[model samples]
Each structure stands twice: as C-alpha cells, then as structure tokens.
Target: MNKLSIIIIFIVCLILFIVLSLSYTKLGTFDTVISSYIQHFRTRPGIYFFQCMTYVGSIRMYVPVICILSIYCAVRKKLLNICFLVFNLWGSRYLNQVLKLWYQRPRPDIHTLTTATGYSFPSGHAMNAAAFLGFIAYLIITEHQLRLWQKTILLVFTTLMILSISISRVYLGVHYPTDIIAGSAAGIAWLLLCILFHQRFIQ
Candidate 1:
C-alpha cells in the first residue's frame, strides 16, 4: 500500500487499540463470553497445532531468523531493509513491554493450557507475529515482481499466520481476545509507521 493508505490504517488500528483497551479495562461481558467460547472449542489436535504456531511466534524462533536476516542484510549492505526489519520485529517487542507495563493488566485467572508470565494487556506473541508478518507481507507485495495469484497466496498466508498466533494466545488462556486485538493493533500500527517512515526518508 501507499503512504497515505498506511497512515490511515495506522490511525484506524490505534483507534481500535484504544477502544479495546477501554472495553478490556471494564471487563466487558462480550470479552468474557467470547473467551469462554474460544476455549470451549479446543481439541487435543487443535491445541497441539496452535501450540506449535505459538512456538513459531515465540522469541526463540524469531531470534534466529532475525539474526540470520540481519547478517544477510549486513553482508548485502541493505541498510534500509535491515533498519525496517529490526524496528518492526525487535523494536515492536520492546515497545510492547512498555505498553504492558503501562497498562499493568493482569492475565486470565483461569487454568492455562500453557504457561506465560507477564502483564497481559497486549500479548507479546500476537504483537510480534503481527509486526513480523505484516512487514514481510508489505515487502513482498510492494518490492517483488509476482503474479496476482502469488500475491494473493502471500497475503492469505500472512493473514492466517497472524490469526493463528493470536488465537493461540487466547486459546492457551494466557491472553483475552481483547488483549490479542489490542496487540494486533499495536503491532500493525508500529509496522505501518516503520514502513511509512522508511519509504519517506530512506527509500
């Protein structure tokens, strides 16, 4: 997308984040109900699948990919791409930490299917996955030469990747749906900001 479109999206996401944050703070009935509903549909295989996806979204997985990508970028001397990637991934992570602290929201009090310890206003996995995959999708769609089908597949895959990771966080009982929504908004906002800045000043 173009700069204007990205800016608009960023604004929309920020607005969404604000709305969700408010609802979450009040513990909206819908939030509680949906959280229950999502957890209710859980199956053994589904748990395994999402757990694996959550692992893929984890810092453990992203760290190596970030290192390898950064090294390749360094070797190729692609400074702009390197900066954008780091900002979208690593910087977004650090920003999420600040946000979690600022909000000081607590995780669910239910029995968790997985373990995670942190204030859970915004899910780290959800944010990081959104930022990383959103950036990759932007790069692929804008910088590459591909057929329409190829672009469609990439977009679809990116969407699924983001959705799966976010849903996993909720399903695992570590995050509420609002937390994931807020996290996604925060992540995509940062990603779009980086893309817009990179385009205007670096490109």
Candidate 2:
C-alpha cells in the first residue's frame, strides 16, 4: 500500500485505541464473557500450545532474531534499516510499558494457565508481536527479489504469528480480549507510522 493509505490506517488504529481505552470500564461484561468462552476451550494440550506460542512474542525469543537481522543490515551497509528495525521493535515495547503504567489495569481474576506480572490493559505480547512481526511483513512485501507468491506466504505466516501470540494471552487467562484488541491497534498504528516515515524520508 501507499504511504497515504498507511497514514489513514494509522489514524484509524489510533482512534480505535482511544475509543477502547475510554470505554474500558463499560467492557466488563464483554471481557468476562469472552474470557470464559476462551477458557472453556482450554485443555492441557491447548495450554501447552499457547505457552510455546506466547514465548514467540517474548523478549528472549525476539532478541536473537533482532540481532541477526541487525547484523544482516549492517553487513549490507544498510545502517538506516538497522535503526528502523530496532526503533520499531523497542519503541513499541516502551510504548506498551507506558500505556500499562497509565492504565494500571489488573490481570484477569480467572485462573491463569501462565504466570505474568504488571498491569494488563494492553498485553505486551500482543503489542510487540503486532509491531515487530508487522514491520517484518512490511519489509517482506517491499523486497523486490521475492516473488509475489513468496511474499504472500511470508505475510500469511507473519499474520498467523501475530494472531497466535495475541490469542495466547487471552487463552492463558492473562489478558482480556479488549486488552489484546487495544494493544494490537496501538502497535499497528505505531508500525504504520514507522513505515510512513521510512517511505517519506528514508527510502
């Protein structure tokens, strides 16, 4: 998509996040019902599956990938790409922390299949997945060497990763559905802004 379209999506995501934040208090029923519904499908195997998937969005998992990508960029003499990659990933993380602190929303009172700390209005996993993986998808799409079918496969895989990580939070009973929604929205907005900046100035 063009930069103009990216800007429009960014604005829409920002608006959606703001609206969700403002209406959080009114979402108690929605959150409870959805949480219960997801939890109902929880089995030992399912929990184990999500536990593994959730780690895909974790710092420990992404850091090595980021380092590898950064080194690749450096070897290719694409310093700007390294900067963009680091900024997009780390920036999304910092934003997630600030929003969690601002909201201070507690984790779900339900029995959690996994351990988590800190506030949970917006899930860190969801946000990081959306921003980091989403940016990677953008990079893949823009790569001229990749065939159209190759790009499609990579994008579909990236999208599945993002969605899996987001849903893992809810299934594990560590986040509300709205938390995933808002986090994804905020992360996507930030991702689009970064892309727009690169297209307009860095490209």
Candidate 3:
C-alpha cells in the first residue's frame, strides 16, 4: 500500500508476467517441468477440491458473494469500498480477457475434470479469486485494528484460497502452470493498482 511496497509489487508482477509469457509462448523447458510436476500429483480428492474451488472462484458463483459484501459496505456508508470491490472484480476479469485474447493460447489437450471453453494462457478463475480475495485481505489489514494473529490468519487464508484455485486449474489440465502464475501476477498487479487508487482518491 505504501509507495515502496507498491513499487515492489509492480516490479515482481511484471517480471513474473513477462517471464511466463515468454516461456508459455515458446513451450520452454521450464514451463514443461512445472506443468508436468503439477499434473503428476492429480488425485480424485484434489480434483474434486479444485473443481469446487474453481466453481467458487467463477463469476457465476462469486458475484453473489460480492453483491452481498457490497450491500454490507453500502449500509456502512463505505461507498468507496463498494465501488472498489466491483471495479476490481469486473476490471480484472476484463483485463484478463484482453490478455487471453492477445495471447490466444489454446486449452491443453489433456484429461480435464470439467468442461471449459476459452483461451487458457491465464486462468480467469485464478485471476478473479486473487483479485477479490486479495482485496478482502487488503481491506482487513488497512481498516481493522486487529491483533497481529488475527491479521496473519486472515492473510494466510486468503493466500491459500488464491493458491488452491490456481493449483486446481493445473490439476484439471485446463491451464498450464505458467497460466496460473501469469494470472496470479496479473491479478495482484491489478489489485495493487485498485488499492492505491482508492487510498489516494477515496480516503
């Protein structure tokens, strides 16, 4: 949220995105290694868990959750937060779409636990979950004067949700590992921008 922290996030996200893009485009050895590693560990339980997580992460499922949170925020007169949440959710999805079209990466031709129809360089579920849950974590840390353990627990849960969704995409073979990495990087970058914009203009 601070300038230095924002700069670090930007730098790291950029590096991750660019590296993943190049590797995915070239089908490089590193991409192969990571994707193979992820696919090798797939199990029935893991697939079911990830399928559930992806459903939760999907716009179809998560939009209602967002709506409920927005309503709560509106009742509290936190208009800025409500706006930020909607903007982050929709805006990041749009951004992810743009990136997907630009890359036009095809879905992997491996066994998939669920049906998916879209370009797969960046998993939309991963991006959306990271952006929305990352926003929730950010709000918690900034607005609540909670104890250290409380903040830590919340942040860890948020991180786990993000990772679980991303890993699920890989396990289901709908996305390459690089795709999730890129999605996560793009999501964090967008979320950071939204956070900075809200902090600068709204509060």
Query: Best by TM-score, which number?
Result: 2
* Candidate 1 pairs with clashing backbones: none
Best candidate, lDDT-wise?
2
User: Compared with the true structure, what per-residue lDDT tens digits does model 3 show for residues 122-201?
Assistant: 87888888888899888768877999899889989999989988888878878877788889998888888888887887
Model 2 score (lDDT): 0.89
Better-scoring candidate (lDDT), 2 or 3: 2
Query: After aligning candidate 3 to the native by TM-score, how far in Å is the CA of 89 from where it should be?
Result: 0.3
Ranking by TM-score: 2, 3, 1
Global fold similarity of model 3 (TM-score)? 0.93
Clashes of each: 0, 0, 0
Candidates in order: C-alpha RMSD to true structure: 1.6, 1.1, 1.5
| Candidate 1 structure lDDT | 0.86
For model 1, how many clashes? Answer: 0
Candidate 1 wrong stretches, greater than 4 Å: 71-77
